[model samples]
Target: MSATARVLVDGLGVDTVCALDRGLSYGDGLFETIRFVAGLAPLWSRHMERLQHSCVRLQLPMPDAALLLHEARSVVGGMDQAVVRMTLTRGVGERGYALPTTAHPTRIVAAFAAPAMMGDAYIHGIRLRWCETRLAIQPSLAGMKHLNRLEQVLARAEWSDPSVADGLMRDTDGNVIAATMANLFAVVDGVLVTPSVERSGVAGVARAEVLASRAAVHVGDISREDLLRADEVFLSSSVRGILPVQAVDDTVYVPGPVTRALQRHWRGLGFPMEQA
Candidate 1:
């Protein structure tokens, strides 16, 4: 852990996790990366909703929300701006795939200094590339921020260019899924659209917020051609807010009005969206 980060394990300040933890051994866990402003998590309910849903799906016990929030606030302390990541795993388990008869879930809450605002990217738009790594279609595990992230790790490792902000990933069927770390939205035929997470991809908190907004947003399959020909494109995440897509490979885009509108909406939510 970085010296600037504060950690709490199972409600106690700690830096080490049991080596036999299922999260480390089998990747049996779920996590949420939340942005805190003024010592509060603005989207706390949404993050908890997702975490609860994932707990039910994974059969892992859900920690009490009040306790989780307490731990989150404890780690964040009085920081005006921070990033709090909550990791829940099916505690230490026997050396096998069999589920423990009675499980003791591990809760790790860590708070780090918020990353510097991507002012230039937010203002001029960000550059992206098509990643070779494709997401597998698995409805059973879809839409949850689970710990199995080998695909994203591999896709991210494919690039080292500091100029590239992120990479867009496609599913095995060649449908545009999302950026490695964010959900994608595009304006096609002047209609707002985001690819469905029912088959693959994460249902990010920011994406949910955008969908709940007044905009008529469509959730369906998006192809590379559709994205290329779209009127505008942007990416959304809880921590990063909204990022306009300036280009994908050689295809260039002039950040359009729709992207700006969403950015304003994000700003309205108390997250910062400033130009450098």
Candidate 2:
């Protein structure tokens, strides 16, 4: 079958390709969706680190970062709000699981308009449901945001209510991991606690900053009961930054002291904050 993709490759430049590349074939690839402001990415280094980590795990070669940055800048076209997506595949290969020595890696960089900052996500906070899809125990791939996201997709599909903003996931042993796309944090007993990404969940770039910068905060296994008793809860993501959790199950929170302060620090970190 003929390919329809128009993304660029490291050595081949821009070319027409099929969608049924090995990436689509066996989820044999990795990708990053980065939000750019005024065609600039403050967190490009973080994204590059994660992307390189993923490439190493998948045995996919890292593309020339200098060249990739040029492509990313070119695609935005001076848009104030932009979302640059970078995808790397092991290129086309034979119909098998073994890595092909002859196959070259495919590179793609595209830009789009950014999504609205859930103003309410910062102030009024968000609602969450418990997901039934449990993340698998794979430490080698645990913290990397690989393309194999069927677990998250299935968990997200469990809810259709627009009111349910996101879903909290767990590992196979029922230990809390993170939200479908974002990381989760809770303040129990005035201590900020989040799930340790051991068996599942992508360790978000934003998550690392929060843990390192916040006081008396660290990673741990937080249960539903722990959240119910916590003073506040919030979500974090590379694009979304920090968001308060107003309601979880039948419980409600006033967004707590730590969560609010973190929101302020997060804004100083360069992400947009809720309008006061």
Candidate 3:
């Protein structure tokens, strides 16, 4: 694990960002948390596609995908395992809501040590809390990996217990959105039911993979009652992959056969399944 984070700003080696940057001021940006093993991000194309879509939606200049990938590799060096965070922010702008005519987006790519989770988490599953911080319904920002994460930050702050893996979040309409840092999925009967990010939450890469798989998957609305009544519950992310949820608030669920099957599939895809 690297003790220091390697960072590149605008394709150049830099560690500092301007205070006037729109991302810092108004969270006008998009970011992706990626997992790299053997100096390669397995879902590089997906991340790029999402980033491009975000750029178009936000009217920010899109960074060169090839250049960004090259810089990402340079930051990773020869690290066997690492987590790369890519932040693309609308460059320095004056204090106002008005759009800046001269927008030079800043691309900050950094690599840090991949987090080590306890192996027991994958086996026994982890507990989750029900966050009171409800996500606002903003269809324009829905499903994009934008940098406005105050909602997630507040939800994560609701719990301090290290035993708690994450917190399940909901929209203002009381519809289940996802976990604070991952996408939520529940196995009902033999089908996988996940919340649609059309109104809130992120469209996770791991969640995308699961939806694309041959498994019986359904994307639609999910309520808190539905989650509690499900046979199995799990969270998916690019870095964390599929994490079985043993409990959410008072509801308890053991990692069922379906959760185990997905875990095996992830491991087969060359992800490091072993908990640190």
Candidate 4:
């Protein structure tokens, strides 16, 4: 826990939500999991863009960036490294499904210490499992980090083995989508290939950074066979950065040259991913 781990509603320092809040009644909200170092979010613009896109899709008013930044800075004040999560809800509403005539969006921002999983995972690699739960094809909800995440919740609950660092999930059509917690990427014949999030899955900020970097990137459908036969594989997230995948099921893959090059690239960008 961070000494500054606290939640604020709207712009006030508060800790509770109303019973009829739309976010509680229905999963009507968007959230951004941001990594802040020295009281600044390096990828703040990208996270804000994604949050604004989700608000537009949900017919909710977008928040002002200056206010959000101020609140986030307060929450992460004096922290060397922290994870600051901001959630915006549609506010309280009636019992019916109709949108309230007067919608007051609720904002909650909280901070926590960054989890300590980057040491060994970054140095060596992580083992993965194939999850049985599949994500439904909902184009309207695709690529948005909305509050409704039961699909990921169920997929993450499939395994209890501590050795399995993460699980890979597919869509209803059996196309590989992403890992339960991070975006999936594979290097096929020296080209960086990542599953398109058009039909499902969240578009991770770190994944977007890697795609926009000087790496050869391709976005399309990746089958199970394609993933297993790829030369290198890794996962991307805001908190964890890039994590190499050591094995999936019975197959084995050592952290290859491509993964190493990307790690170097990410470190050069000021996201020191290795143990100090």
| Per-residue lDDT over 1-276 for candidate 4, one digit per residue giving the tens place of the 0 to 100 score | 334476677867777789888998899999999988777788899999999888999999999999999999887787788888999999988888899998899899998887777568886889999999999999999999999999889999998999999999999999999999899999887788999999899999988988888447899999999998898999998887889999998988888887887788777666758544
TM-score of 1: 0.97
Score every model by TM-score: 0.97, 0.90, 0.96, 0.95
Compose the digit string of candidate 3's lDDT tens values, residues 152-196: 999998989988889999999999999999999998866889999
Provide the overall lDDT of each model, using Cα atoms, as 2-decimal numbers.
0.92, 0.80, 0.88, 0.88
Q: Which stretches of candidate 4 lie over 4 Å from their true place?
A: 1-4
Those runs of model 1 whose alpha carbons end farther than 4 Å from true positions after fitting are none
Candidate 3 minimal-lDDT segment of 10 residues: 267-276
Q: Which stretches of candidate 2 lie over 4 Å from their true place?
A: 1-16, 274-276
**How good is model 3 by TM-score?**
0.96
The digit string of per-residue lDDT tens for model 2 on 12-59 reads 446555676898798888888886776778778888888888788888
Candidate ordering by lDDT (highest first): 1, 3, 4, 2
Clashes of each: 0, 2, 0, 0
TM-score, candidate 2, is 0.90
Number of the candidate with higher TM-score, 2 or 4 = 4
